[model samples]
Target: MTELPFATTRKLGLVIDLDTCVGCHACVVSCKGWNTENYGVPLSDQDPFGATPSGTFLNRVHSYEVQPDHGAAQLIHFPKSCLHCEDAPCVTVCPTGASYKRAEDGIVLVNEEACIGCSLCAWACPYGARELDQAAGVMKKCTLCVDRIYNENLPEEDRVPACVRTCPSGARHFGDLGDAESDVSVLVAKRGGFDLMPEQGTKPVNKYLPPRLKDVAPQIDILAPFLEPVSKGPKGFLGWLDRALSALPGEDR
Candidate 1:
């Protein structure tokens, strides 16, 4: 049997910092814009301007409110995308061999020409990464901006993936995960990075470093002023209306 090509273990992946991510959807929008034009079929929207507009997207950012202390909440924004696993379940489950990890860079990609429109690969992915392009009748997911990265026409600094390039908060970093000395590797080491849904044993290459929290107590007096009642001024019509509304009940008013 031929040995699995360890020669091509470059493991190109992303390291997303949870601390710096400011819940901006720039990465999501940038991804949609780039993939829509370059990917096999555009990420089509059904009635884009109408009610209940929906479209296919390879990456999505989720905002979660985490309350670590009493009356204190931190908004955590997670940019969810393909992890590009070393032991990718999606690749193994593909009947057509369309979903394969690139030998050159270890990036998993769907060969649109070879794909049989089977959704098995999508089902195998634990991260919910694969999206079916209804228009093309094939599966699509993040290519890590393969074409853009390799394009010589683009500037050297601008050659990274769209999501990483467009992140205003500097939350996303793309580099060779296989290189132990890489910046991403160092960041992962220093920050105690973790992979999402590791219990599935997919061995995801990408990592998410949790937000670091300081133990300092928040100043309570800052909130006290907002809680105090405002003294009523000379009663104009609007002021009378406000007083009447405020009198009608809830403590918040």
Candidate 2:
């Protein structure tokens, strides 16, 4: 039997549920911790206590307020990171072959040794996934926890990315998206998943399941037991005088 290419056999990806995410940043903290300790270089912060503090991070959670003209406001917390695209622009734009997609698992990675500190790859990426590691003088991004995911010494269940494992709300999922029978594929199919910035045509593997809406009644019962009544405190001397004056004939209060 002809062997399938390694990339096709193992296309690792993430499936994010927008509906379940509560905007908590546990995943972000987990990613920072894992990547800083285990990956090529640390994600560092500059002037931590200063007025305009800045830091380098592989993952960032963006909170977007989505409001409809007729409905209540909806908060969408989108955790942005490397999508590890099948056709990654960052790889192509790299002057050196420092940025390349892995043939074994389709994970895009950077060879820091070969990188020349040029920011071309960052520009190529429309998703703002790449960040410059000033300390190492190279571009950095999410490795999908490459070191941990493939460690033979680690337990099988703990082999997943730190972000995926640490998510409190179960909003993050990691699996082989290429496989039709994978849980991610099933979730995407069932939840009507969508890709962000499709116009860029990066063909990002990560899928985002849109938030589901709750049903609301057209009219509310103001006098319902569950509803609190508005407090009407006694009026002051001005109010008493106004009422007394209003009781007078032809008085307009």
Per-candidate Cα lDDT values, in order, are 0.86, 0.85
Global CA lDDT of candidate 2, please? 0.85
Residues 110-144, model 2: lDDT tens digits: 88888998999899899999999877788989999
Error of 1 at 93 (Å): 0.6
Task: List candidate 2 stretches off by more than 4 Å.
Answer: 1-7, 217-253
Candidate 1's C-alpha runs over 4 A off are 1-7, 69-71, 218-253
Error of 1 at 68 (Å): 3.0
Q: Which numbered prediction scores highest in TM-score against the true structure?
A: 2
Instruction: Give all TM-scores, in the order shown.
Output: 0.83, 0.84
Model 2, C-alpha of 155: deviation from truth (Å) = 2.2
Q: Rate residue 158 of model 1 by lDDT.
A: 85
